[model samples]
Target: MANSEPGLADFTKHLRKWFETRQLSSETDYSEKLWIDIHTLFQVLAKGIDSTNPFSEAVCEPDNPAWTLRSHAAEFKVCQRIVNIFLFMDGLHYVNNGDWQQRYIFNNEQRLEEYLRCMLGHVALLQLYGDNCDHIELVRTVSNSMDPFREAFRHADISKTCANMNYRNIQIGTKLIGLTMARWMEQLKGTRHVGSITSDKPVQICNQGQGTNTKEATADGVRQNGHMPIVEMMEDGTTDVVKKLIKKGKDMTDEVKKRLIETVKDSTNPEKTMEDILDTVSKCTAPGNACVQSALESVHTSVTPVPPNPADHDPSAISASA
Candidate 1:
């Protein structure tokens, strides 16, 4: 834990430098140094998240000056998670620019789709941190900033219109971190003092996941089938949540499938047969449907949209596609 002391110090230092400098600057600065700074800052904060409690207060050193945004570990951690996603998706927007599109159009037409998926993942992760007012405020800010991206993604000709239109999307993303820090500063101005050298919040492991207590179950350090509770898992390197369903190698039997179809039929409109439901599902699952594509793209950035083949849409196509 003490090893994190220097890292935390470095984080606070760079954070102050980054915000104060950016606040004073008038122009949009996207230099290599700028990105390197962002990368370094995000790395440090992310590392701290693994070693420190995100929701805990960062106690400052007695003699050190106060830092605004570092008031809570979660503030910077949430910032890192959301901003990193924006930056990663920045490439898609950049490449979509009219000037670059001619020469660097995606091999497929799903780049915007992929970016939306990253946004969803960012939102989902934010939800896991619990809804503190600060977190709510952060989410609201992000939602407002992302409105344009969402609107652009839903356009009829999204691929043609979704170039982020003059770096607007990335600019919004850039301002988000600064805006978040500013809000924190304004809120804390006369209220309380923050510390530069801070102690991490104590970890509290308790009942979680389906609201069940696990303290007594693990009192003797016994393993529950060699698996720690999901609540104990850290976000770093946690890819299981993002895994693609197809890769799980699970299959649905025809009988079970028929039962599900019957259930759906019985529950809603009995007049609508299994074929009707399959038709609707198939259409939604089609790679070319804008709504379907938008959702799929928002979740899986790397997934290429397969071109629709006429032959693949036959009556049995539903089962075959599944």
Candidate 2:
């Protein structure tokens, strides 16, 4: 129990206290406050779904902060669960999002869809199962609820939409749903902040995923014969990892930023421009990816609109005609 870690001890204590409070018989009947709050937060997040990140855009300051939209993604799940207790368990509020289709853009007839999805995600892994499924059943109670997951799995195009199932049809894919659940579990299990720091430098990325600067730190560590290399790299600006990656020729154009603008296309607001897309991506680079991507963004967004029922080109007919 390396509870000595900076934020670990507090989380264990918070979990113990939260679960213990839920176990009390009286606690069950007290109120559904948490659930209500989470639903409200989802409403807020829903607005930002039209943007790349709702919570961060709504909350975080957009200066040259050490963090970016990724930080908001990290915080979203944990905050949602806490909000859920207030909404459903406390009865201080109820779990609902109005006009699921109008809100979700798929089932204009289903208002509760987003609300249901949020609640489903939170409670899906609660192990309370049969006992805790009363609300879950409401989601299942939709005319097509029994096969909602399947319908979403078979019909919905997920990669182009929010993994949370926004902007697209209610058809979020099965794999997307599972991955979303896994992220929730990771949060509940509290796996993000666990690890030992071998270096003395100021390392920004705690979760070393796609866009991490690990190479230079490791090299510096080897040459200096200590973790100090890592620390120095992290603190003093030895982004040798970035240099190596650049040399290897991988475009670190902050793919997340590019994807962010792409998400706006399905929005009901207006079509996205390529310039805006490239502009957002440019913001991600240390010096900004201005020169390289300026034309690319313009060209990317310059796609010509086609009629919904455009005539299909028959390859065989064309070849025969030729």
Candidate 3:
């Protein structure tokens, strides 16, 4: 069920029109790259959804099956599209300076959110349709696909607003995918024969020598090697944690600096400790912090709003008028 040429063309045309309506197409370089990425994402998703068949090899060997391979590849493609959308949105935000509604067509954020919700829903539905059929491999494939996107988003120098929105969406999508897999595994376990013994089940071991049991042998081996406890063994763990904290602090430094400068200009607080300063900075710089956003909103409302450009029509309104 791979997408045909006409279908692909129609999808691309629709996307192009959407971008054009939003005035995004006015920027030649941005629009060209955006359209290419969108087209690729649409093609990948269409092909993957069409070609996936989780039941093709239902009775094959437990370890590997024809369906597993096809489904895994398809799911990976779906995940790639998810990540592409995020990166594309980040790129758009990087070049544009405005609120979400100002930057894109009306309802664009809602549309993207709906699309992600539907994609996650489709994956859950696919697993449900399999009826307790094992798709652990597919689940693993989808989970692993998220790593690259996570790393990219983690390090991307994007606004807190954009980052928080996309990050929450990605997190939700992955959690849904994981829950679907968990449900599938639960169903599979429920259907298994009562007498079955899984490979993970502990086995009875006879003492071979020195009256040593398996548990005792394991302890003895650890003691002989002078292995520290798990937490203590992680010598670099504390250093890693501190480094992450410092990185987070550095990332917020600009906002913190702005707040500090503002405070100094206003001379609101004459005396404050380092702890108090940090606490104030943390409150001000935290993503989506209610206090900071509320203050900004008040300031924003005090200014006269500029009318939206007539050329930038709302896509939803345009559709309704048509």
Off by over 4 Å in 3: 1-40, 46-132, 152-313, 317-322
Clashes of each: 6, 30, 0
User: Residue 269 lDDT in model 3?
Assistant: 28
Work out candidate 3's RMSD over C-alphas. Answer: 20.3
Residue range with the least summed lDDT across 10 consecutive positions in model 1? 313-322
Better model by TM-score: candidate 1 vs candidate 2: 1
Report the lDDT tens digits of candidate 2 across residue range 106-213: 233122333334333333222111111222122112212212322532433111111222211111211122222323333433433211212322334322364545
Give the TM-scores of the predictions, in the order they appear.
Answer: 0.26, 0.21, 0.20
Q: Which consecutive 10 residues in model 2 have the weakest lDDT in total?
A: 313-322
Off by over 4 Å in 2: 1-108, 115-204, 208-281, 284-297, 301-304, 308-322
lDDT of 1 by residue, 115-149 (tens): 32233223233223322334323333443344354
Which clashing pairs does model 1 show?
59-198, 60-195, 113-297, 116-298, 117-298, 117-299
Using alpha carbons, what is the TM-score of model 1? 0.26
lDDT of 2: 0.29
Across 1-322, the per-residue lDDT of candidate 3 in tens digits comes to 0123342233334544655645443444444544354344333333333232222122122323443445464434333332332333323222223222112222454344333333322333232222211222232233234334335445331211111111111111112122222233234334421112122212123123557654455335434532111111112122222222233344444564344324322232212322243333344535433433333333311122335446532221111000
Of 2 and 3, the candidate ahead on TM-score is 2
Using TM-score, rank the candidates from best to worst: 1, 2, 3
